[model samples]
Target: MSGSDDQSGLLVLGPLLRYVDETSASVWVETREPATVTVQRGTDSASARTFAVHGHHYALVELDGLQPGTTQAYTVAVDGATVWPEVASPFPAPVIATLERGRPLRLAFGSCRTSVSHDKRGNETHGVDAMRAWALEMAGQVQPADPDDPDLDPSRVPDLVLFLGDQVYADETTDAMRAFIESRRDIDQAPWTELKDYEEYAHLYALAWSDPANRWLLSTVPSAMIFDDHDIRDDWNTSQDWRRKMEATSWWHGRIVAGLASYWVYQHLGNMSPSQRAQDELYAQVLAHEGDDELDFGDLIDAFADRVDQQPQTYRWSYTRDFDTQARLVVVDSRAARQLDPDDRAMLDRDEAAWLDEQLRGDVDHLLVGTSLPFLLARGLHHLEAFSEALAQGAWGDRGARMGEKLRQTVDLEHWGAFQNSFQQLAHQTIDVAAGRRGRAPSTVTFLSGDVHHSYVSEAWPVEPGRHVESTILQAVCSPIRNPLSRNMRFATAVLSYGIAGPVGRLASRSTRVPDPPLDWHYAEGPWFDNNLACLQLDGPSLRMWWVTGEVHDGDHERPRLAKVASYALDADGNPPPREGTVSKLRRRLRPR
Candidate 1:
């Protein structure tokens, strides 16, 4: 049966390529009914029956025994009937290209997309969707080249797309989401604009991924994802006070349960490798159920999600992948893994921090640390957050602490800088790796992050002069794949990130009891507020990074063209050399269209 056949009771969401290795691959899909899903690549195929969760049916089919480094076209079938590639798929057919030994990794990473129509209204209000524009460009549908711009080579397409966080914003509902929520419940009630249940979340994912261009891109590109605060709520688990406030709400239990549960099925499950999936107790149960009858895991999954919410120590959301000898991608769970105790605020709890420390060793050419919240914020913002944390912890006194706590939540000062203890621990660990005290120092220790709705590159240096660190430590941030901060907010961000705020912030922190920072850093590229996506290319000893945003040309808003915002390169030692020009000249060259 064809995928579009309403009577087929077959595929609904995807035949999305998930994790892939040299010998195995995993494809995820949702169905209208419980059925066996199969993935075939050449003569080899793998099948898995759908498991029901609250009446929603899904399966992750595994394809194994593929040749290393081989690229093979794949097909999806539901209940022994071919369904995908939909006969008229306009783009290239989906394929699985396993990671080859010694091949340099090229990755596209971005965060924070809002689901809306791709018409003029949506384009004007939300800016064009960067992922959709890139996908169109990649598919050879739209190509606008500039003489000064870097070449757009289809052959060098990224092997994977890392969705850093905010994959779906549960708190900041789009108009379509609000309409869906209102259809089911009273709009005037508590949590009026936020998602309420697994049903709502499923609909949100459908809206987020269902766009034709993006859907095609996701089908072909393997994806890895993690959640940020917006995936549950704005400032989710920000502090002990925030948690207490949320817990007091009438619908919080339901919201948290649904958020975590939906995240597991839609994003987290696909993030795991085959071996990791085998180790998961819940997935093991799915595998152990051998009967032809469909398996229902609704109640069990609900209970599991509740348990995880109540005791996050029971689960591990962070994952690591090593790309042969090229690089190691350590995608961290920063939001859910927080320890918000007033006495000991931490970005990651002890267990999670320990796991992260263990993963920070070096052996490859580069180490990429992916956290939704930028590890190194603008220097000024870093000091401000650190100062806020100290005041919130009663560093000055009880009254000051109360005022600080209020300001902290109000201003959303809860990144790594706010969690001083955890930040210090990670900083020390990263320093050790860079200093070659832990392992063979890579060319660079790069922190890949988003969540702040702007893009930038920053380089950090040791506090002591003449400190010999072999690895270049840098921070790369790309955000808001579709969402854009308001003009007023952008002005505020620019002032705080680039102007007098740095010295002022340091003074503010010194006025409080906040300790001195372990290191220092400055912006190397930008603090640009654009709805953009970033590409990171590791080619042998060189690394290139660039940001691209969709720009409307000649009033053609519906078909926005991709435009380069800024580009930077790191030499063999991962150092971005300063350009020999005036600041005005540099700005003129890098400014967005």
Candidate 2:
């Protein structure tokens, strides 16, 4: 129990804890061969047969009938022989943690991690991996907490880790990923360095998750994921012109199909609760079968992915969950469900937008909106994006439109701000939620997002509101848990997205038909470029957040230390959380009262 053997070849990857509720938890695994995968805790056990996708075997075992507000160490097995814990493991035992009714919730989240080496050179190039540092910190803990138990000590580990996007960079593959790609196909071809099919994706994931530290962390902590543009391609569905250009590529067809299909098998399957999975036709198909032979989903999944890509209306990627009466998490699908037509450009298609509207209501202690892309960028960046979108839609002239189109793709000027209509709709809906127009107002309405490589927190207030808003409206962004923007880009962001750019961008957008944003915001904390992970803790009627980064200590890059970068809290009356240390300190220091 106190040692770890670097085991290899027992299983392909994972014993990843994916879903947990009051009475059950879901465990996912990729097997070395077709076999029955089981999850066991003491005497109680749950098992499921493997399903093949393009020669790869996988299973999701749901362990039910668990006691609420309890934590128990769990083991994974292939055909009933323990494959996890590896006999001599240095890491502590992983646990099955179920939520108790009306208990507080704590979650860790961030996005944009690129898989690379963890040694000195890699750390120098990409900075320390926040996730790995977190895993090491967690590994030192003696026991996992019963997350909802008021009597138990707060564990450093979170109940769940919400991975916002770009979990694996299919577009920006690492050298090892590229070598894997070369082993599979011709390097001279189109989509050369990028992933081409599901087989390649399988290898990519193995590369990403096989790290002992991160993998151990994932096995212990449940995670929910959504994809971003880099998960498929950079600036995916950015505009009509961009779509056209990608469509013209010879490799785009296989790429998108494989991307979506692999995403389904690897990430989306465990996102649902038992009832939701039962409602899924494909899941039902896999489970309904009881033949002696294991089910092969290779062709079925590819076709399903293709169909979903062609007609996004056939399926809904967005999902929601409630933590008793404490919190509601609505994770929206920002990358897949977009309306890219010039006349009706929307970040989310009509159906997806409508579904999100329904989930945006208030009635809980805290309301959390999880979108892969930031809903509110820095004011300057938002205005600039709005102006670009208007110009691309022929606000200025044909020449200006062409220039705007080029600029949009060139600088990645696509976000909620670019889709002004969609942004306004959500802004108004958020105001309604805060004002109790839709439901009883919560203590806080927070948008949790990550897409840009830098992290920041912004405070928003409705412009010229007629009624008192009952909840704090805020945007908290934590980005690039590993990958970071270059130094030059960080400096540019500080200038262009923070200070002078706001007035200039607003002036530019005034020349177009883009309506004024209903809510206005200013930075409360950061534009910090550190590779960090963030957490949100819902404590009774109040909410708190903090960001942490991995710092190399004593030249030990492999076992970097965790360092806190920031902290903030939400209040009852919707006031901006005292600017970290309150304006009083800064006022006293700078203004000389």
Candidate 3:
């Protein structure tokens, strides 16, 4: 149903381009009130009536019958009146370019952004937002002479932006979030600075995505997203002990419900293909409802979120998208679909693990695995986490186990390494695929990850001398599109990740009866703490990655330019050897500009 005249107020947040395929696209938007929204592409259009959850109105308009391999400009309207591309828009009109067959895909990805103003104060605190710099660069470029040109221009827009995790921080509430919370409830009361309910989450999203520059970029580029611990709380689902402790709290139920329900509406709902959305129960209800009235989904969504959290097997947040024969993007739900059983802790539950195993098979030239947590952390950190897990499980007797639990929680030693069984299973699967045992091996089996607050590239190798994997096994991490680690933390991370802690951790783990890892890896590029964004290009049999951050120039804080931090190129053979003097050179180059 489309609205006719009689709508009030501009859009509160987006007209974000979500999932896009060859013939269809999904665009999500938020409005100040209940209104029918429409997205128009050339002469084709799609419309949907807004639905209400906690008094906020939203709609996801699905555009179908789009031509493959064509770029079309689009506009958004509310209640029959155009609301987007305001009079004198600084940038070009928003567009959605559908993917074509047999084309190399270029994707940009990053994670961990804090909501703050873009003025001098905010830039000083969090560094200039790399996303804003990227958006500006894209805007400055003239329309490409040939859209399908593979190596056309570095400024040419990417096909999609994969936001791995921590899209918003519920625990580390910004000043704007805190102000909104204080206005509604007593600051001294429970749930204090963090978000308390769906209403607050709605506001937080507005704060995060409302900036005009980033908003326009989001509207034009297709995006896929997943949540990390900070989306609900720091160390969410860290362990059964942590889970029990949180469950006992008065506000934990409301927080989780709000977090998951809001995530479904704002992020996950748009990540699915039309066929996938058709199978969703809640989405089916949305489709069935008729007329112009706002459909209230608060109670239904709350119930759904509660059920999914309690029995994770009932729903799957993970999704796999195949881009013709070029590549396959498998985005895993690392946070929710976890087996926290003390005796058999795993990163993925039984059903989720089986699903991932199936998805790990190969035929395409490149296989991209998107998980919020990095699969292969620095060897030192990996060994330390494994040791901690073993000690927590009483590998060193009862007294050691108690201390281990405390240390685990304190140090946040919870990644793939902490869940030994799941890590080993996935490693074996990856090894098989890389060895061509599962299927035709891809040139690269690259793991795209974020959430560590720093960026780096690592390559894994089988331990045995003669054992060889045909495909390159790599971990590429980009984090904190706006947030940067503190100075002390950065120092510690560099010390540990650069080989100081590996030997010590291995010795400790040996004493604790923790088994050795099947493969060993090292940092090939960086442990840089700059707030940055990374772009990966897969062209034929080669994979290239480059990291860029915003750099202020000539006392101009607001208009920062994009500066390249580093670049790495890997051929079909595997990752190139690290440049001889790269460590010292990169450390100098990456210092805060």
- Clash number by candidate, in order: 0, 4, 0
Model 2 segments more than 4 A misplaced? 1-8, 141-154, 572-575, 580-593
lDDT to native, each model: 0.86, 0.84, 0.86
Candidate 2 global lDDT: 0.84
Task: Looking at model 3, report the run of 10 residues with the lowest lDDT sum.
Answer: 142-151
TM-score of each: 0.96, 0.94, 0.95
lDDT-wise, the better of 2 and 3 is: 3
Better of 1 and 2 by lDDT: 1
Model 3: lDDT of residue 174? 93
Candidate 1: worst 10 consecutive residues by lDDT? 581-590
Could you arrange the candidates by lDDT from highest to lowest? 3, 1, 2
- Top candidate by TM-score: 1
- In the range 276-342, model 1's lDDT, one tens digit per residue, is 9998978989888888888788788889989988898899999998898789999999988888889
